[model samples]
Target: MESQELEFHTAEEDAGLRLDVWLTEKLSDVTRSFVQKLIEDKHVLVDGSAVKSGFKLKKGMTVRVRIPEPVSAELKPQDIPLDVVYEDADIIVINKQKDMVVHPAAGNWDGTLVNALLNHCGDSLSDINGVIRPGIVHRIDKDTSGLLVVAKNNAAHLRLSDMLKRHEIVRTYEAIVDGVIREESGRIDAPIGRHPTNRLKMAVTFRNAKEAITHYTVVRRYPSHTWVRLKLETGRTHQIRVHMAYIGHPVTGDPLYGKKCSLMDTGGQVLHARFLEFMHPTTGQFMHFEAPLPDYFTRLVDLLESRSSGG
Candidate 1:
């Protein structure tokens, strides 16, 4: 494993941006959390002085970052079943199930989609995201069942990632929210960042936050809940959940962001990634996929309908 060093000189346009936020935007294949860790480890400096992740940048300021090599991941190929929606030589679209983690992380080392892909695709997965997240181009929350596309090789991975960055990929979700949305359709445009006090959760924040947008349309209204379809313009972590919560209509059953509900048995947020549309990485052709709502989500909808009708 080798360490890499990067240097940047802040311009007028980059002024006022937080150090960790700017580095995450400028660096490829790295996350803000990872950059923050580097800062905490004293591997990031501004004008050769070790600074916090929240250090505001100034024009002409020199920033340096030292990225350590990723630790070797002892990932095991699991025989977990996958509901693959579509597959070709370049990519595989999966109708991921609820309660399934996308990739390996601190406490979740096995039974992830990556482990299954390793066994299903063998050595064909792209390594651009390293061993921990090979082939994963994007992710949904563990409780958000939905469609996700996995890249088989580096070329496909880079192209798909670029498409997401340009907002070219279409990702839509269906969510049962806690409140009845008065408007038929709306968009939530807000900046999102890690919560100031709670490092484990994300929130709508202006300081060191990234642009996030979510467009939603009410599909069915109940007395207390609303079924809505949401389209994401930016794929920030917890973007839809945070945005919806910010708008006071948090997704139902979202333990992290919403009040508990007895009408739903869902273990977490009642949000599903139901639609995906993108261009084929190798074929230069358009592709689309739709995943039906899981049993729990459907059951909740039925319950809501019954309650609305006084059944």
Candidate 2:
């Protein structure tokens, strides 16, 4: 229950950067607004004195940060079932099923993976991602079923996050698309941003978008659908789904991007985070994980292959 502290020193290259901006940049998982709140609450001090969020940084200035213990009392742990793939002192890899929310949010404050992890790991989970997302490093969409690694401690969390930012963590997904991809493989390099008209959706657009790239190779071809494996070079929000849709091969059952009536009745996109490869954050050894497709996915693929084969 002790408050965690972090110290930072500015360099010549960091001169003139805003205090809040520098904090936000240094704390990879934290947002600028949250950093500003820390400044306003007097939890952030520059050179032993509280400073405004807009205070400009100078070379050799020392900045101290205090991270309060998350108000985690509100999060009650329930005995939710978990499909844990791998566990160590520093990390746990989970094979999350479809329709399972990864963390607590607006309408999904309970029955989330976080709640389940709380019950499972007790106080061993990382607190760097704030209260709701403690221990969570990266996230997949709620409807996406697949593998995700959770850090058990702060050191692991920061290292894993850095791996993701550097694209050193290799993530591969399995997906079924709405149409047949004639070519054996292809790549989609486009900028993706929030849909201008619909805030809830993402689109490939030039306006305030980030560079996104997805490379796909055909796994199998059906009459009207294609099974593919996708690798992300840049992991932006909804990068795979948005890029696939942009290339006219929207993931089947993707309510945000797919056709009104998909090839089948999947509750959501039939994409799974099938593979993860990265170095162990603590031990510095290579680690790899894979989660086989859920029952419904393989069953649907089998049925499609059957029909395509005139069975």
lDDT of each: 0.86, 0.86
Model 1 per-residue lDDT tens digits across residues 145-257? 98999999999999999999999999999999988899999989999998775444689999889999999999999999999999999999989989999999999987667
Count backbone clashes in candidate 1: 0
Query: Candidate 2 on 42-161: residue-level lDDT in tens?
Result: 999999999999999999998888877655448878799999999999999999988778887533567889999999999999999998899999999877999999999999999999
Candidate achieving the largest TM-score: 1
What C-alpha lDDT, on a 0 to 100 scale, does residue 73 get in candidate 1? 64
Query: After best superposition, candidate 2 residue 254: deviation in angstroms?
Result: 0.8
- Among residues 3 or more apart in sequence or in different chains, the pairs in candidate 2 whose N, CA or C atoms overlap within 3 Å are none
Q: Give the CA lDDT, 0 to 100, for residue 267 in model 2.
A: 63
Separate clash counts for every candidate: 0, 0
